[model samples]
Target: MRHAVVIIHGIGEQKPMDTLRGFVSSVTRNQGTDGKNIEFYSKPDELSNLFELRRLTTASAEDEGRVKTDFFEYYWAYNVRDTKVQQVLTWIWQILFRWPWSLPKRIRPFHIAIWFIIFASLALILSGYDIPFMGEDQPMWIGAIGTLLTAMLSYLFTGYVGDAARYTSPSPGNIAERQKIRKDGIMLLKSLHESNKYEKIILVGHSLGAIIGYDIIRNLWSEYNTKYVDGKYKDQLLKFEKDYAQPENVALNIKPYQSAQEDLLYQQNDGGNPWRITHFITLGSPLTHASFLLAKNISELKERMKERELPKSPPVFEVIKNINRFTYLPDFKKPGRVLHHSAPFACTQWINVYYENDYVGGNLSEYFGKGIREHKIKIKGSPWLRFVPFLSHTHYWSDDGNLKRCEASLAILTSIIWDKKMPEKDEKEKQTVQPDANELAGLEL
Candidate 1:
């Protein structure tokens, strides 16, 4: 069987090949698979002329079948082009007003105390000169030089921070970008269908990319249902067959009911959509933040609010409760009534993997209902540790110690990717795998 896998990168400045190469290399190496068997391509001919992609074709280590994976970078960093000075101001505003980082309220006093200490030290350095904010007359160069230096440093750090905030937020600007990402994903899937004879489609997204993947899959599923499974074209199909029947065989051939009934049975028993997604995998995804991200859409927000009976923004709890999961048709007393059921299995199976120390990761099974599964890998620190979010968030694809440490968890992901079934765990279910920090701390693509 042939398979097409689409991988989407999370927040930050991303290069197509850079992200793909790192991920594929790391996963394969950790799985004890040979990287030499894989072929990588940049800007493959299968996609749109203007669209960029990093494509790879590799034989599955567990099977004789071959798999092709495409990496999509929905890079939004290019949209931001603030001047150095502007970036400095934006950084100040975000730090003071937005306070993007999550920290314990108990530690707030210490942070404030540290701020005062820094301020006092700076004042002491320029003692003889009066600071304007302090009601002292100081040389213009003192302030000018300080401002310029701050701006320069901010400019250097502006690219990732600013775009990450925008990409993760539910503000108007970010919503527009989200829509564009979803539309582009749809186009890519369409192109893949026209160009290849793939039997399975799998979508994998990391971090914020996972949320984007959800939007794309939801939209495509809706489109597929509308076009094929809704019974809208049944009349047209029967009409065409009736009109084409010969006079002598008209009575016998007019058995359009039997033909249509068989066709409907085929659709219901098997997956009705030819281009359906077989699986959706999310790595270290902050999908629990969906409510916060969708706050800007009033119509959708209103529906969510109404469903949850909430007066204000839908909380994470409410959003999770409202999540719609795919399910197979329930059993009925009469087999004939079930014969025309359109979907025999869930539209897609969701597999989510996250490290315990990752702040952005949450159990998505609670949201997507029965079809979703969550796997938590052990990390060095408390999963909710506040200070090291950056490190924990980005190292999910490390090739060495961390990957090896979480071997059991990674096995689940590898099983899905290689089209193999995972071995059943023991009743107690505890396994020992230790992640090495040195190998995972600085991953290079």
Candidate 2:
């Protein structure tokens, strides 16, 4: 069976294929499958017609470890239209002005640097330090320097942060663009499912793309969850989610649940179900701070989860035949149950990888749900630099990190993407973050 991975690039003015190529290079280069190096051949992107898009094919591990796979990218930066610096600034202002109690304790340390940047910018303006090279002696050069600086700031704020500001805020002005982004994404996945060329598909997202990926799957799952084959309905797959995925099951380890999800996928497929998305992989996802990105506060965030607006891990459950499940009856005559609106997660596994120094990311198990497999890795950085925001955001794909994570981000991806155990490395190299059983306890203010 062939596996397909659709990687979504994070924030910034990312070009088509850029993120995909970098990601493929990293994962394939550091493949932990056996001791043999994997070879990738450029293939025609049967997944997309666009010439800018690409597909990389790799043979499976000789030991039948990782299966033959095709890697694809869903580039959405161009879809995020009409981004404004003001919108970015407004979002930042709203975040910065929130009450201290509203901030997630673990995330507060990262904010210290951002606050410093903001204050320094304000101080520079108040002290008349306009541009780096703008001296009183160069009065005529003032216009040139100012123009140059304005363009740079515009690129940084609008070109990058603009994507996050618009999609996340969901103001009246942003709704159309946001909807368009999600619609295009859903259409892409729908196309893949319709193609019927692959047996399994993996959705991978990085940075802002992580949050976007989460939104895509939860929304996309609804279109297919009910379609289970005739014999698969009211089955164990749905039962596993209900019994073990409760939002309150804090101490629950999701490894077993992940295995059960794969089994359910295989059952559905054998029964002729076409929905083949098996796992979701997020790298440096800001969904960690979903309270600010998705709602006004933590309370509202939980309310959103309860209301089924946001999909939670294990998913929300209701009493069904004396068994708690995340399903509802769509047709009483049929006698089978349809997954609830937020139950797409019931059958899908979520793996989140974050750099310890990247303040933008965190363990989703803390806030989203414990079913999410969280790996907090560390990159090479000064002791004091580990607390900086955005410092390690772009290094997720870099092979040059301390890799104090469960393993290399590549190793983590290899294991989850292939649904196999970590490579047979020595125990000393398997540096991993200990699981913290705390609730969103300090996740949000």
Candidate 3:
């Protein structure tokens, strides 16, 4: 009956340990578990190494000199297991409590108001000052003044805006930083599994963490054969072997059928059992699509156009050949296709919870446009909410309706983790249970 939860946070947000705790507690209560036999392990600080690594890699040449210093700082900061756990708890508290207080520090309303006033004043001055048209007499000073004001605003705001965006953007670096983070995350998971002899472990991730979760599971499956060694999941491995059998084994062992990287991990001598990860839940993920349409679409369009323009007439063959030479070619990788966003949906072992109204990266259309366009999209319908609407990628965890959807999704996932059959409820069936008001108010640090 030993069960554990590993919660990873989304981008631009610190670890969501508190949110997870609340969600877990709420679900357990709803399910009448009463938090009796559940063990929660939140590792918010485990990613500090990742953050530092990102910082070092992203820093300019002058700052790169201190990469080693930053690395050591992270090593010392996150080296201890207990300390990492405490850091996670601390981060949970900060997110649930300190975030509101610190909001002003990040973005002061007064500063915003002042900037608004300045922009308003400039606009008024510009409106009053006129510019001359080709045949009309107008105050030409207005255009000059407006341009000057715009230039001034650009000069003052450029760096601030850039930095703000950077704060939100994931670290842009070569493969090393990503590899380090992935390695660290896997190591942390392995350590946790070793420390806690949980029969079942669930990894839950939001945004980038979702990608990390996929990598971890893929790595695990790739490394260990289907055998649970000792009390360490050797049984599950044997079960898989018995269930899938030899032909399936051949399929898994074959390359291109399974990713080469995944195959390598499967063959690796990691003692950790990949199949131990019973369930993975991803929220507001954007893994299936490229960040830019140009990366995915332009080439597709070119191919389509080329096919259409393939000379039907023999006389037009030379003309078509010349046309092909001038066709547009897109650099697919330069725009960086959104990786791991589709992992949750695409993964057989994972359950995905999407939100309605995720502004930045929530729309499946952005990533799975071809599916929608081709009318090939299908989702397992929920009785509680027949349809989960697309929401802003970042807001899914916070929105009330979406949160309920997430809860329902987690309930289903929990059932999967326990290997219990999901109780079928008709579309008309409703659980009118209200959240415990006392528990909501009773969330102390």
Candidate 4:
């Protein structure tokens, strides 16, 4: 069976296939001296239909019935257009104007440097003596430097930061922008599923793309939530969920939870269900600060989750026995239990990886759910460097010689994407996903 890797890129003026190419390059090049020699081939992107957006197809071991993966990018930067300076200004007002006490605790310390930058920029702008090419009092060198700095800042504010501001804002225009992105994402997934080529779809979202990925899964799962085939094998999956929903078992290991999720996913597929996305992996994701980015506070974020607007890991469980966080539709044509709209994570396992020093990414299990396997790692740094950012967000993969954190991150990713082979009826399958140790072992935070 072939697997599809749909990677959603972060903010910025990212072109089609820009992220997928870089990501595929890193994944392939870092396979270590041991492991399968995977080769990548550029194939036609059927979904995008754009020459710039080619699919990265890897040569898989089809002879041995080994699952191969195809990588596709969900490019949505085109939807965020005509980003006005007013949008950035408004977002700055919303974020910089807030007091430390009002900000979320996790994001509070991170905003100190942001506040300093804001004040420093204001000081420079308000100071008439520091005018760029507009004022006569400024020296030629000062004016030249000021003009260059203006151009740089303009690009940063409009292109890079504008994406987050436009998407996260609740304004009517922002809502429309978000809707378009989500609709396009849903369409892409639907097309992939309908193609009937992939048995599984793995979503890898980086930075702001993580937020988009979460929205896509939460929304798309509703279309297939109630779908089921008549079968007597549903009780096992149901019992697993019921037992997992207990308060005592809330702090359980993620491996067992992930394994159960993988089982339930294939069961749905075997029963003719169309939902095939089994794993969602986020790297350097900003969703770690949901309260600051998505809502006003922590209470509102949890409220949204409880209201079924946001999907949670170990989804919101009910006290009822048979309908443990699921909808029991007795009046349907063929009566069976169906997953609730907010229970996408009940089947799709969320695996988040972030550098310890990355200000944008942090532990998400506390906010999203307990079932999320949040891996905090350190990459090419001294132990005391955890307090610094040092552009760690951009260096998730091993771009340099340091494969310390990259190995650990790739281990989790490879383990999930490669997946475990299914057992046959005659004899139990002993084949397991054994990625190279050199490619999958490293220090953890």
Candidate 5:
């Protein structure tokens, strides 16, 4: 079956295709020689790829049965730039002092350190600090002016790229902005899946992008359940969508979810939701910091814990619930595969990869509950480098010709996405898939 992967990048002033190219390089290096083993096709619109299966060779065979993989980069940093500066200023303030209060004890120090750096740098700049015998022996006031300009530029940089500023803010506008981005991402996935080009889908999100990815999956499945599984907002949504969702000149790839089981069944067996998320991969994610940067006040995590409620990490809980909602049936009409009863969860698996020293990365297993896979790789770097919060955070999946970290991380990631596992005769069975061609692709595109 064909596979599609969506890559969501974290906060940054990113150039188009920069993240995509780097990611492709990393995965390519890890897989084998670049152009020979992993060929990447850059598309005119957005997505690009050609992840070759080791066993699949000839051009026609590769296109027909091999694991054909495509990559799409979900970009939203540009949207944040258009937001009001006042909102960003408020976010800067919260990030400096208030946000740390909401962080877990383990990660609070990193947050605190980051806060100190921001304010301290600004203070030092404002104080007119100057290098010895430099800048044409500029006046102290001139230094201050230069620093002030620098500070403004820095603020703009952080505001534009620091997705956390928008994501974690309590402002309704910021929240709405984030929701819009997630909606766009979800719609993209819907089209990609409905194109009937991919059977298994995997989403890879890094840093704040992981949080965005989490929301997309969480909301996409929730919407699907409401319209397809539970059958709540069916006809109204369908009728409204026909008039509003599609543009006059454009064609809609995915149809509205139908209320009837027969409709959903037909869509599935026929071509409705042919693809499902087989795996979700997170690298250097700040998912654990969600309640702090994502909520209005003390966050739902603390509220639930204090109130003796579910005590859920909202994103993780939603992901688990959605992944477990339904299973993909490759051959629905087959005698044994047909008539499989509906189950509580879907079959999507999550693979979270983090480094011990990553300032923004934290363990998700405690929040992910049992039966979830979590991987931690030892980062080989100068001991002093770990102290640089942002550097360490971004290095997890970066491929600057450094193969160790990328190779280590991709080893586990590839295993989850491309490994082979036999189908269970029934839903009650639990099995580990082999980390080979058979596990995932079955050499089938």
Candidate 6:
């Protein structure tokens, strides 16, 4: 099947239909395919499908109103997940591609949990006895339970509860609301699926649009596998089942990991059958650093601090260890992994586009400033450095170098689409590191 590309705009930004058309033209000018061969769609068009679910079932005025409300909530939650995923993805890319030695600001929540667990284990070893509050007699068991409970509570409190309003505010409430938005997007994609004219599908998103793209790809893959495969892809199916089998899975399934699935999606089966996606790209995404998204204003800061009761004497060392076990480990001189959003880190199949200088037009920095305020940290000269040379966040895509980088990145993506052989890495350089500019220039494209 021929490949198709879908372009989605960022929040409150102009749809990139025309700019994408130009990009396609530029790409095809030196390549084989023409611009028309690439399919382009806008975020609104894709999102509009989510709204159609309201008609799927009849309801009284109150019920219908509730449904609408629920849909918006889901929409916002989906956005939060998308943002997280983008930041995480960016962190991964920075670690792997940009600065392998330098850790990305965002650390996976799972990793954070491990860090805390290690500390908790140490605390138990040091105290020689489990603390009394855990209701366990054995020190080891007490430490383990305490660690688990504390980690769970911290995750629930910090990861979700603390951020709940942020996710739900733009659209809030229950599953019905979320389902409506998802249904809208799904319905739209279904229509596109029915067309069947395009063989390859490329998904491009910015910010929340990127999150939605992740959800669509995941749901599409799930539906396709459920309907088409008959245990042939059992291994892949098993992983998905393990990951998405619970009620919480429902939330995670629709969240940013949907984007992360792109990494696992293209893995080849024993029969050499690979899950195929034409391409995926995200621009100016904050998936790598999510602290940017939390409430940043003084009022929001005071409220969050009050809610968490920061003055509660810094979680007991034992509690701190337990909480740290699950949360992203904080680097005193550097921002925590919370900064790395998921979009860039989670992308396995597609090349991610990022800017060293601008991120969604300095919105990330502004948002991050708010988060810093909550911690009573000064924004200026803070550990999280802003190092933009000349470009602001919004203009990254328009810059000549960035545009070239995009082209180079897209070339790599195109190579993947055609199943072209990728360049082999030099074994001689196992211990040596390469510069980012050279790496970009050395792209096979």
The top-ranked prediction according to lDDT is 4
For model 5, give the 10-residue run with minimal summed lDDT.
336-345
State the lDDT of candidate 1 residue by residue for 1-445, as single tens digits.
Answer: 4567777777665664566666666555534445343444554545633345546665443453445554444433344444244544453354344232332232334446666787898888778775355445667778898899977666555655555455555456457755666787778777665565565667888887787776676555544543334333333322322222222222322133333323332343243345446667888887644433444333555465445332110011211223221121223321211111122113355677887656566665433333356677765434443245446666666544355444555566667766543222231123212234353232111
lDDT of 6 by residue, 321-389 (tens): 222211122343432221011111122333345445433312222221111101011112222333532
| Candidate 4 C-alpha error for residue 35, in Å | 4.2
* Global fold similarity of model 4 (TM-score): 0.85
Give each model a TM-score.
0.58, 0.82, 0.39, 0.85, 0.64, 0.37
- Residue-level lDDT tens digits of model 4 in 66-117: 4668999999998998888888989878887767776656678767878888
Worst 10-residue lDDT window, candidate 1: 311-320
Regions of candidate 2 where Cα sits further than 4 Å from its true position: 30-34, 60-66, 110-148, 232-242, 245-250, 320-323, 381-388, 399-407, 419-445
Per-residue lDDT tens digits for candidate 2, residues 319-384, read 545556676666666645556778766677888888876777887876788788888887655654
How many clashes (backbone atoms < 3 Å, residues ≥3 apart in a chain or on different chains) does model 4 have?
Answer: 0
Q: What's the lDDT for candidate 6?
A: 0.36
Per-candidate Cα lDDT values, in order, are 0.50, 0.74, 0.36, 0.76, 0.54, 0.36
Total backbone collisions, model 2: 5
User: Candidate 6: where is the Cα deviation over 4 Å?
Assistant: 13-16, 33-182, 218-222, 233-278, 291-350, 360-445
Writing each residue's lDDT as its tens digit, candidate 3 over 1-445 gives: 2445565554432322344444444333333234343333332343333443221111112221211111001121122111122333333233333223333222234345555786887997778755234235546886688789977655433322222222222334224444565576677567645654444456766665555565665554434332212222222222222222222112232222222222212222133334345456666554432222112233553343234321110001112322211111123322211112112211123445654433222333323221111111223335423343333344433333344545544555445444333222231123212334453331111
Between candidates 2 and 4, name the one with more favorable lDDT: 4
Q: Clashes per prediction?
A: 5, 5, 28, 0, 17, 58
